[model samples]
Target: MAKIWVFAEVNNGKVDTAALEILTKARELGGEVEAVALGPGSTDAAKELGQYGATTVYASDDEVYADYVAQPAAHALHELVKEHAPELILFATNYDSRDIAGRLSARTGSTLMSNCFDILGTDKARTTIFGGATVVDVALEGTPKIALVRPKSFEPEASGGEANVMPVEVDIPDDLKKAKRVERHEEQASGPKLEEAPIVISGGRGLQDASNFELLDQLAGAIGNAAVGATRAVVDAGWVPYAYQIGQTGTTVKPGVYIAFGISGATQHIVGMKGAKTIIAVNKDEDAPIFQIADLGIVGDALKILPQLIEEIKTRKG
Candidate 1:
């Protein structure tokens, strides 16, 4: 039986949803599921992971691990993998996870699958593809296989039983220690994380200018639980934060309802949001590419349409 290991990420005492999603998938794979948390006293984090199907939680409480730097954290996880010799290492496809996955693969000489949507059974080996396209079923050519699963790909299952917690010591390699983090910056708290938002309103270059972005913010606020998103073009124009961009180069979102306002819907952008349960597109161009994928499409100017739509939504909610 191959043991499965999940790298649980914790920031400001809260476990990332992606970490729980990985643990849920690990449970489906069966065998002992061990979650590893490396930070300053992440015992509470480890216990929370146990509720999500982590049988064993390995925690490393070290000052060096306090800062969320990739090098030291990767080294710590690598050391844990070396000791446990798990068959599969699962990580969330966030920036940190991508960095760690690459390093772990190189260190262990294991196959790496990044940004996998679903893990289809492991007979010959674990199977996953990029952007949920091009199926690549691979059996581990090496002892351990590394995989970075996309966030929101799998729903998190409830944690059962108390997780067995243990403390582990990792010697940070001199080479890794050399790469030190000088500063840490945090983004101002936006209304809600785009991915976690139930309703999302996204804009593109069709909106015209940065000044038009106020319409997007107004519409989002009208919808209450809505979050704002931007297409690649609008993001490139410096209208919104890169984190709010949705596309191949940006965040992949799976919202209950996704509204693409003024977006032409490039294939790269569509690929990221095609998983949305219900898609509504509003673009002035009748031949916009976004219409093909949208459940409902309106051929009209976003500036004029948005204000009216906001009024209607407000009326209906009231």
Candidate 2:
């Protein structure tokens, strides 16, 4: 049997959904699945990690990981790699994970395959290239191959067991702690997060103005559990925050129901949401490329149709 390790990131006192997803996939690859968790709540999150198929968890509640950036964790992970010698290491495709993976790659001289959506046996992973139009298999060569997996690539499952937790020990020199975290600010959001939401309502340049996003807000409000998202074009135009942007350069969402408003469906944008279970696209242009993939297509002005749709939803709910 092979040995695999997953970097399980924790958020809001729980294991990150993406990490759990990766853990589940790692378990399916017929390996001895282990996890490395850091930060304040990592030890507490180990039980959940075990429930998601991790047989063992190397947990570190050291403040250095939370107080500073990626260097300290990278150094610690490098030491762990030398000691344990896992055949493969999996990481979630997120901000901190990417930072740590890059630094660790430099330290270990390993082949890092990023944006992978599937693991093919023990030596290959599948990813999309050229704006997600072409699918290719990447070889995982060299010792302790590292792979960064995309969000929503696999469904998470619980093994109904607890993992044996062990403490991670490493010494960090002062030079590695140059960059320190002074403060942190998070956006105040309601309902579900955009990536985790079952229903996603998105807008694009066809909305005409920033104020038109209010229509999406109203629709989300009416839907009760839906989250709002925007295209890169609208986000660049200052219509919404970068967090709401969904594209090749932004967040990737695979909601159960994805409703697109006025998006022309560029390949960059489609790469992010094409995995959605059902896609509904509304655009005035009948020949829009989005219509090619949309399960339901509406040929009309999105701005004009939004008000009527909101009222109808409100009336139906009432």
- Per-residue alpha-carbon lDDT of candidate 2 for residues 1-318, written as tens digits (9 for 90 to 100): 788999988766778899999988998998999999988899999999999988899999888997889999999999999999999999988889999999999989999999999998677999999778799998878888999999889989888768999999888888999889998886748789999899999999999999999999999999879999999999999999989989886889999999999999998899899989999999999998899999999999999899999999999999
Candidate 2 total steric clashes: 0
Clashing pairs in 2: none
Model 1 residue 3 lDDT?
Answer: 85
Instruction: Please write out the lDDT profile of model 1 over residues 1-318, one tens digit for every residue.
Output: 778888887777889899998788878877688888878657888878989998889987776776536788878777888778888788888877787788878888888876666765432333334434566655545668777777778899876757999887777766766656677676844787888888889999988998888998998898888889998888888998788889776788899999998999887787678889999999999999889889999999998998998899889999
Q: Model 1, 242: alpha-carbon shift in Å?
A: 1.7
lDDT of each: 0.81, 0.91
Error of 1 at 43 (Å): 1.5
Q: Which lDDT value does model 2 have at 85? A: 93
How big is the positional error of residue 61 in model 1, measured in Å on the Cα after superposition? 2.5
Distance from true location, Cα of 239 in model 1, Å: 0.9
Candidate 1 least-lDDT 10 residues: 122-131
TM-score of each: 0.91, 0.96
lDDT of candidate model 1 versus the reference: 0.81
Model 2, position 205: C-alpha lDDT score: 95
